[model samples]
Target: MRCVLIISKMQEMSNVLLIIQASLMGVSLTLFFALVLSSLQKTDTTKSYEIVRWLLAFAMLLFAVHYIMQMVFGFRAQGDDVGAVINILFYSPIAYILSYSILRIGCGNNYYRKFRIMSITGTVLISCTFVGGYLYYGSMHMKGALYIMGLLYFFSIVLFIIYPMKEIRRIRKMVDEESGQEPVLFNMYMRTCTKLLWISALCIAFSIFYTPLLVIIGPFFFIALVFYIVCFLALGYNIRQMSNIIVAETEDEVNADGVEAGTVAVKVVMSEERKEMTKALIEGWIKNQGYASSEINSTLLATRLNIPKRQLVQYLREVEGKTFRIWLSDLRLEEAKRLIIEHPEYSTETVAESCGFSRSLLQVKFKEATGFTTNEWRDNHARKS
Candidate 1:
């Protein structure tokens, strides 16, 4: 009787967890759609954002359907087969859309038609095979069908892995062509997307074996649900960041010439003489005053130089082989070193403030750039003097 009560209680808890998971997913989906809609309305040239928004919306919808089906018919003997089939059908499409979205975002918009056809063909093939096999062999003898579906699923995972590699290669080529440099943010973004893809592939592989375990142990579903929700949230955040980057790039192009008109003169590339002059001016300003201000940033520096921030960023990348942040950090580190060595009386807090670095950040950057703490540098220099 006690065991029966415990079992009932466990089942109740499982249902509650499942409902919470579903609600979270639904809310996240709605919020993501709302954000995408807002971006679409506000931005005129968000092709990449549009593709990502729709793909994510579709993926979220499929997830909702899968969860609903699992909740409704997952435990029933007569309905379990149908539920499993529906889940399987939804899984491949969701995976394919997400993989394709990542690819599109990473690779740019060159081969849309080819990718569209491939996506449609793959979806049709997988769906038809699963449905046809179920009808012919029935659920009891559907191992061959499942195997075929699994093989196709694995193929999609392969594409997911392959596309990211292609994206990395594309980025490398771009860096090579554009002055042998890439922005730090660009590199970080690519690495993050690659990591997300690898994780998604692993999750999909785990799900295939996880479903059976879920029947014997209901709590496992809760763990899986949490994992899936967290993954989706992380992916959604990445998509949002990507959308912002696209919007910024579009704005940069539109405002490159300091003209607000819909059409403007083509921007002439900055010549070597001009590049050297700009670099010298920027360096002089930083050395004299900019590094001491805590509020200094790319925009502020650009304003000082009377150039668009994007142009400044490009100049820094092409001429200096560093991002604005890296350039700023180098200046700050130089100032910090001087302060610690030549003016050892100033407290670390004062040095950090005067050098435009926060207290914790000073510690980190000082150690990273000089291989010594602030005090260590000061003591070493004091001994030398």
Candidate 2:
């Protein structure tokens, strides 16, 4: 009977250990994933915005490493000491700094220095309280330390929440001014992150109830890690959706074969009639004008065709898959080559002039368009004949 009781007790202990180990493993995995996604989010266009997010991810990674080491090494913080110290040192400062950067970016570039100083002051003040709490109540029970840490964290998290919201709103306003329309996806993603920040902050405050475990290893950290991972995935989805929409629009414009009224007519691949009309128009214009230098310019071509600028651009891109200037230069240079080879009596300068280019311009454009100088092109053609 005594042996059986001892075996049962040992089994119970083993089970408990297994549960704790599993939880720690889960948290570590979550932390690593958060770090990767957060790194991607660091690509914000503004340097100030990118820096704050980078610091937040860096601090969180450090906190994760500390937790993993403690879990594996059989370490426990006496009372709620660990939670208080980490909350002050890593959590509060990261939150405050990130918030301040958002606010500064929203307000304007000019306000960044002032907000940075304010964020630093907040970090210092909070760090002092955290250190003081630990030093003064080092020997106190877990409950006493928990109460002190909880109060300090509440204030810090509030500051963090308020600043980011104000800054995000400011960003929205600026975006609205520039684009002259509210960007739905951009605002939605920012709002989602801000909302997550609020929820994660609340989770931290709630985790104070589990102060003993929190001091050993906090659920707040794990929860924050998960929240950030979700935020990044959500943001990535929105960006991809926007990208897809832009690509679809471009493809649709290309597939439209005919001139969408007020545009230079586009040649349809299957419609020989429209293709013939387009070729005739281009040829007739070239033949009558005696090859002026202005024919190579897209803006000049669009004006001569009585077409809208955007339509002309789309027509050239879709039908030829080349820009107006490139297509025009190829045609002009090819004609110049034929003239040089067939009419040997024509001088190189005269051939260049007749093709609507100065002697130097002809040589440069010819070499750039084809991989050869005019003289080289002449020799290659003569050798072929």
Candidate 3:
């Protein structure tokens, strides 16, 4: 009687777990689909914004499809391998989409050819490894096949992360140095990368580490957690900031027939002649102490120069090869150095005002640029009055 009772108890538990699994998938499907619609409705004003937005939508759609598949195709028992197969198919692509989006934002189309080649090669190899191993042994649930899949995915994730990071760093350094713009801060990006790493680790664990007690329950909960987290990120990450991540193009890439990148919306190219004219105008403005004005910004500068705001921004990035803030800051820094050394009698407050820097900010920027604090630099260069 005890043996029969034990069997009956186990059967009841199994049924309850299955219901939970189904409920989880159903919830996931609904949530992901709603995210898809929300992403679609959002405005994508720039090319980079458009690409990332659509990719985000597509990735969510894939998640929705994945959950649908889990519910439809034998949502697994302890011995079943259907859920594993679904994960490999959808999870890898999700990682790819995310990594690729960042790559494009950082480097533009320069790395597109190489990225495409890698995508094709990786996909083929992973597919073949998973399919061939299953066919050879006629057992989809084989540990060897799943481990191989996980290993491939793990390595591939690492490779993309490393490669994209390199390109992003390189481009950021070059563009900032040339254009006087600050480099795109990777704080948020690093957080996203951390999430991607977690996803990869989970993929590997899900493949090889399974207990009979929590078979279906594990995958269901995993799917819900990851899917919801992704939805939040996709919906929450400020899309406007993406436009701020300017990717530089080479001479060959920026020429006629080449795509213009890193603009808010304006396609009006700053021709060399116009850029020179603007430079002359700006130099004259500088001579008149235009930068010393505390309340100036790119918009005001554009208005002052009689150029469109869009054109002015392009001019700064392309011709000036620096950001407006950097350019202005450098001008002020030079004035501060001059005041501190040549006009050493000037008060710190007077110097800061003349150079358009707050006493505090002058010190901060001076430290960053010259690796010495304002007082330290002044002490080293201080003249006998």
lDDT of each: 0.62, 0.55, 0.63
Clashes of 3: 7
Where is model 2 more than 4 Å wrong at Cα? 1-46, 69-88, 97-115, 133-149, 182-186, 211-385
Model 1 lDDT per residue over 231-344, tens place: 433444444333212222332443464545465656667689878878887878866877677656666667788878667877887887887667778778888887777788
lDDT by residue (1-385, candidate 2, tens digit) is 9999988976665455445545755665565566567557545344544454455556556556655654554233332355344544556665664465445434434434544665676667666665566577674334454555566667667766676576556444433322211145554555565576577666665554444444334444555445554554444344322221121123244336354444576453434564455556567777875355522444445566665545555555666776655566666777887798888677778887777777777888778877898888878878988
Residue 174's C-alpha lDDT in candidate 3?
46
Write out the backbone clash pairs for model 1: none
- Considering every candidate listed, which one attains the maximal TM-score? 3
Q: After superposition, how far is residue 349 of candidate 1 from its true place, in Å?
A: 4.0
After superposition, which runs of candidate 3 have C-alpha atoms over 4 Å from their true positions?
1-35, 39-41, 80-82, 142-144, 179-208, 211-247, 250-330, 334-385
**Cα RMSD, each candidate:** 9.8, 17.5, 9.3
Error in Å for residue 332 of model 2:
40
In terms of lDDT, model 1 sits at 0.62
- lDDT against true structure, model 2: 0.55
Question: What TM-score does candidate 3 get on C-alpha atoms?
Answer: 0.56
